[model samples]
Target: MNPTAAILIIGDEILSGRTRDSNMHFLAQELARVGIDLCEARIVPDRMQAIVRAVRELSAAHDHLFTSGGIGPTHDDITADAVAEALGRPLSVREDARAILQAHYDRSGIPLNEARLRMARIPEGAELIENPVSAAPGFSVGNVHVMAGVPRIFEAMVASLLPRLTGGTPLLSQSLRILRGEGEIAGPLAALAADYPDLSFGSYPFQQDGAYGAHVVIRGADGARVGEAMTRLAALFPEDRAG
Candidate 1:
């Protein structure tokens, strides 16, 4: 089986539609690049109980769990606290995180207030994920990785941790856009998918300028098989190209 991952997004802002949750899609794409199959995603509010429950559940369900949001200096940022609660431990300021954050504050010449210091609090026995843009660190507890809520910081944290994660063979994808409707090629695509059961095939329909187009995407770990599938797909629709 492929190595699977799940993402948990914790924030009242996202739940209330105040902010669009972009972190899940970013993690999904990055995990795909690293050969980790992103199988599930959940977005919960900033409530402590909900955050704790989602973290615990996702951690147990997937090989890797990624969480974004609620780890900032604001009052609503309670991800660190919730993570500790989930693990049945008290949240404490981690020494390494504190040191890094202190240096950041010192360089900026801004006094590190208690609210900012809250960023140093991490779950017990967790490895820190470095944030290159901001020294506020993310952390890993067991299979769950806790990260920042801001899209920029969360993406940087993910990039930092990518090298440390061992992944399976990376997935390869091939796509062609056929000047036809999805209904016209759905049967053929399904048959091709069945022929190469190891691969996944998807057909997406789009309408533009009174014309119909279907984009067929074939993806799998085996490069040769993916190429072969693309060949068969092209044979099914000779006019299809990389539109």
Candidate 2:
């Protein structure tokens, strides 16, 4: 079975509509590419209780839990503390993490001030995730991986963390565009879905130039099975097929 995962987005800005979260989208795609099933996602404010509650719930439910945002140097960046509380782990500035941040700031000709040292505060027994883009590293305690909110830094941290994880067969997907409405195809698609219980099907409708159509997408762990299902789907709708 594929390893299951969840994403926890912790930030007040994201909840306030000031920041559009792109990490979930990126992490979902990347996790799927490596065969980790992203089963759930959530966005919570920077509140300690809210973040702590989500962290416990998601981490308990999934094999892996990735958190994005609220790990910056600002006072509102409370992900570390919340996660530490959630897991009953102590939060402190580790020498190793501090050394990394110190070296980074030193190279950039910036002083490692008190505010900047907050980046080094890690949850006990957590492993540091490398951030090539920025000096502050993300951390993994148990199944929960705490990452930065910035898109660039988050992506970098994911790249560094993903390879260390064990993955299953990559999920394969195939889509067939049909010039028919979802109502026109729902019955057959339902029947088809029943025929291949191992595969998952989706019908996304779209209107282009006043013509209604749907993109029938099939996804599965087995590439051959996915391809076969796509072929069957196309044959079932050959009359209204577009691509």
Candidate 3:
């Protein structure tokens, strides 16, 4: 079976709409590529209790839990502590992590102050995740992987991490754009989906330049099944075929 995953987005900025979350979508796509299903995503404030609660819940429910945000040097960066609390692990500054940060700052001719040192603290028994974009590293304790909220850093961390994980068959998808209202094709789409029970089908509606249409997507682990579903869907709406 494919490993199931959940995403925990921790930041008051995301909750307040001050910052839009791009990590969830990015992680979802990356996980899907490696055959891990992203079953749920939750946004929690920077509060420690809220972070701890979400960490506990998601960690228990999914095979893997990825968390973004709140691991910086700022005061609101309480993700490490909260994760420690949730997992019942002690938090401390590991010398190896501190050494990495120290060398990074020293090479850049910057002072590694107390605030900067905060980044070295990690949960007990966790493995450090390398950060190529930044010196400060993320850690993985149990099934939970803590990562930076910045889009670039998060993407880099995911790239480094996914290859080490055991993934099932990669999911394959095919899409066909139909220049017709979703309602017009709803019945046939449903019947097609029923006929291909092994595949998953979705219809996304769009209105462009005063024209309304839907983009139908077929997805499955089996490429032949997805292709067959796409062909059937195309046959059902030949007049509205896009390209």
Candidate 3's residue-wise lDDT over 129-151, tens digit each? 99999879999999999999999
Ranking by TM-score: 2, 3, 1
Candidate 3 weakest lDDT stretch, 10 residues:
234-243
- Which regions of candidate 1 fall more than 4 Å away from where they truly are? 240-242
Worst 10 residues of 2 by lDDT: 234-243
Give the Cα lDDT of each candidate: 0.89, 0.94, 0.93
- List the candidates' TM-scores in order: 0.95, 0.98, 0.97
Top candidate on TM-score is 2
Q: Which stretches of candidate 2 lie over 4 Å from their true place?
A: none
lDDT of 1 by residue, 44-121 (tens): 988999988998898888999999988889899998898888878778987888999999999999998999999999
RMSD of 1: 1.4
Clash counts for all predictions = 1, 0, 0
Model 2, 1-243: lDDT tens digits are 999999999878887898899999999999989999999999998899999999999999999999999998999999999999999999999999999999999999999999999999999999999999987999999999999999999999999999999998888998889998899999999999998999999999999999999988899988888988888888888788875
Better of 1 and 2 by lDDT: 2
What is the lDDT, from 0 to 100, of the residue 226 in candidate 3? Answer: 92
How does model 1 score by TM-score? 0.95
Worst window of 10 by summed lDDT in candidate 1: 234-243
